[model samples]
Target: MSIYTIIDADTHVTETPDLWTSRAPAHMRDSVPRVITDSRGTHRWVLAGGRNLASAGMTATAGRGTFKNPPKTYEEMHPGAYDAKARLKYMDQMGIWAMVMYPNVGGFGAQQFLKLNDPELMLTCVQIYNDWQTEWASADSRRLIPITSIPFWDVAAAVTEVRRCAAIGHKGILFTGEPQYYGLPLLGDKHWSPLWEAAVELDLPISFHIGSGDMAEGLVKERVATYGKMAAFTELAVDIFLRNGLQLNDLLMSGVLARFPKIKFVSVESGIGWIPFVLEAMDYQFKGNSVAEEHPEFDRLPSEYFARNVYACYWFEQTAPRRLIDKIGVDNILFETDFPHPTSLYGDEVHARIKGGLSDCEESVRRKILWGNAQKLYKVTGPSADDEAKL
Candidate 1:
């Protein structure tokens, strides 16, 4: 039986080689995503146009030592990364009651689909991934919450998929922080209004994960090349942190939150420390700048909307909980493990790390950060009363 009622807000699932191929229709099978070995013997996923997506090594890193030496093949990775049954065993050992799982090769928000010129293929890929995710989560539906992705290039299609996935028990939708990179409308653009409305009406939170958009690719590559593997990893982490902050600012300033009051936005894998500063800066800018004056659509300060609708997750952060908890608000802060990623809080250490981070807070605040907030945000009722008591 587990001791902690924990919910991981930003874990990942390394898709198996056949995740898309097996589910694709006969006519589309040839064009669906499949694995191919490069000349160097590295396993990389190849998309429709023979565009090579990232390798599995980049996604499956749990139990492996150091970012400098990630697993180079599917055979070297922990089974929990792609196998739900194996994941539940690991979850039991870690005492995590539930986890919100994102994609790996699918580019977090499945943004890689945008690279496909065939819109029909792209939409089919999205459906296949979501169907596979649903099947994986079925291994233990109460504990594994699958987040679905959509074709952001088409807002109407996105809305349809959002509704479809929600009807099948998906808790949230994973989307790119910046859709403008794909020549699609930005989050604040009117084209996204229907999607946002569908999400709001469906009671599904729209989650924005760092690196899900195109903004970080160049910087990540540059950092990795300039610095060695470990240093490059550190630089990427910092870069993602800053990018999430910018995304938050964009959504806030865009007046989307103000417009859709009930819709929630989660900044996944983005720590909580910077949130206070962003909120403060947003309020300051709203008061001091003419942007707010020119756009009177904002009913209140950006911070107000953030406090009400925005959420941030922290996996390995300690200082944020200690120093900025009150400013960030316990309700606005959640917890994550980033499981199976290079920098995850995996194995027995996860409990110790999370407990140590929350040691300074009141028990109530700790409970909220650990599971209470997630329960409310994701609408997780947990296992049945009998099942929970047994655990």
Candidate 2:
């Protein structure tokens, strides 16, 4: 077993070129998403009739020094981004121990499938992705945990997929923080009660990765023409990370967390430094607007629900690693590498970053943030990848 103890709360995979084709049923193989090169020498993911859901537009910028031009093909990405064993080896070299995996081809929350407008295809795509992920994680379940994707267009189907993936060992759910962006019912709507209920029962955390139909989508679209693609791209690179704050407010006030107190709502890849400002502001607005009186069932302050049921992850943030841990709450904070992503901690940078950024933190506090919190969140057990892989 690796002597280190760190469980990355959020990381992504660069789905192989044949990710869908290799797993898709014979009848549906041609219809599944796959990569194709355009006349401009850029590789992009497209569906059957070339319905454009762009990933090469920039999502694969892990090792690329410039965000403007990411890898045009899977051949360009760090092998660990797609290869499971390579990922484990990289983690061992970096001393990361374990990591919770997110997605790319499915648009982070499977929002890409909803765009197809074909229910059967959408659901099938989600199932295939989850099944593939489960099989992939079987490489090292204790270290590589997959968060299942769901067809958010159908809540009942989502509930069913949730249960199925849970049974198969997916540790959490990747959900869209703003489903209404796609004209679906809000998370607080009774229409979603089943999903919330199932998550609580199954004890699966609902992780809303940034850009999963969150405000960032709206912001980038509106700003592109005005700011120009170059400027918008640079701004969006960081702006999207903080846009999750929008969900934090809505969730705290919408009574979703209050009603489903046991459902651990995770704001993934969104740094935790903003938690104090936003949660405090949410509490201020809650009292100022008399929301407390209007909502008697919300028996606690907004920040209280955050401390009780919400989690926010952080990386490359010095202030949070230094002092915000107390304000953000120790247990509610989790460490993440966001590995192989443009903003990720790279290679041996992990040890130096932690030791330098969190130098003041006691070892116990650092341990809790690094792996202890994730162990409880993802049900990680025993020795990490190296040891678990041997079994």
Candidate 3:
């Protein structure tokens, strides 16, 4: 079997109750999000309305058997859920040298923070969350990289938070790609300019990750609420694709990309199959006078800007990576293992999955998708071909 060192761009872990209560400042930690596991080992998030966001349906097991519910404690997931040494053991087993982690409950926490009405409270929560991620990544200096969440409702505060995350050693910022904050359109507002400018200046890529708890509804409705959380999770993967194209179109048409040429934008967990059609449409639209008149700064077409400034992360089973590399360019494609998700088992299974999908001719292309692209994106130094070959 041909071998390669994988860098999973999208592995995730849920937060346990003790995360904030034990690690955060006393007053804030007690009121922070708490985790609940059922007798069956099923896990869910318990928040203000007594709402429980279920995790993978099953709970934590004592060792390896399936739990009736998800594990109630973080320790059940790993020695320290964010500990680097524990993660490195798993990484070596899986042939992964590094991973970037997103928050469990913090996916929806940013939206809730926006609703709190006080910007101070919103900023504080974001600050604490970013700090937690920094500490978690620092636990294993070499293997884990953390991504920070943005409080979009407060643009200036959001810029401050992005810079803060960078200063504290975070790799990037995560946003939901929603324009409105509780029915208000912050899309065209000038307030977000600083946030965009900060990202450009700090050299941090802005990632639009799908599937926050309470998402904006008007854009796309790919699923219903009846089928439980899986419906939402499936729909989230679709929503990020739909809204990213919409938001990217807006940014390009509105001159955001032109204004911030150096800023890189990544659409994560959104499969790659849709790129050709989207790029084709934009290229066609720009050829006519329609797109040019809206923004004079756009000298090249939308596809050119996309190739220059944007990238898409392909999940393990997706068709996009193997199928669309030539169209999207190998440099713009990256690999991700949605670790601990229903689809991916967090072990050596990832190696088989990657090797199984890559064609012989595409081996070089696969290397870029699996590691090189991410190395460039995260600006982290990793093993060279000769060094990796020796493994």
Model number with the top TM-score: 1
Query: Candidate 1: which stretches are off by over 4 Å?
Result: 39-41, 48-50, 216-225, 290-292, 385-391
Ranked by lDDT, top first = 1, 2, 3
lDDT for model 2, please.
Answer: 0.83
Residue 382 of candidate 1: its Cα lDDT? 75
Candidate 2, 268-297: lDDT as tens digits: 988988899998888888889988688898
What are the per-residue Cα lDDT tens digits for candidate 3 across 1-391? 4343678887765454555546545655544555666575645565545555455232223233343344445555543344556666666566787888876565632675554455665566677777767776775645687887888766666787788778877888887555553554554456567877888888888887655433555223444445445566565556655666676666556566777789888877666777778888878878876767776777778888888888887766536555667787778877887665444444556666666666543567777888888988887667567635666
Candidate 1: pairs in clash: none
What TM-score goes with each of the models? 0.94, 0.92, 0.83
Which candidate would rank higher by lDDT, 2 or 3? 2
Candidate 3 Cα lDDT to native: 0.65
Q: What digit string (tens of lDDT, one per residue) describes model 1 on residues 256-306?
A: 887889989999997888888889987887788866678877778888899
RMSD of each candidate relative to the true structure: 2.0, 2.6, 4.2
Index of the highest-lDDT prediction: 1
Better of 1 and 3 by TM-score: 1
Which window of 10 residues has the lowest lDDT sum in candidate 2?
57-66
Model 2 CA deviation exceeding 4 Å by range: 55-59, 214-230, 384-391
lDDT of 1 at 71: 79
Per-residue lDDT value at 214 in model 3? 33
Candidates' lDDT values, in order? 0.84, 0.83, 0.65
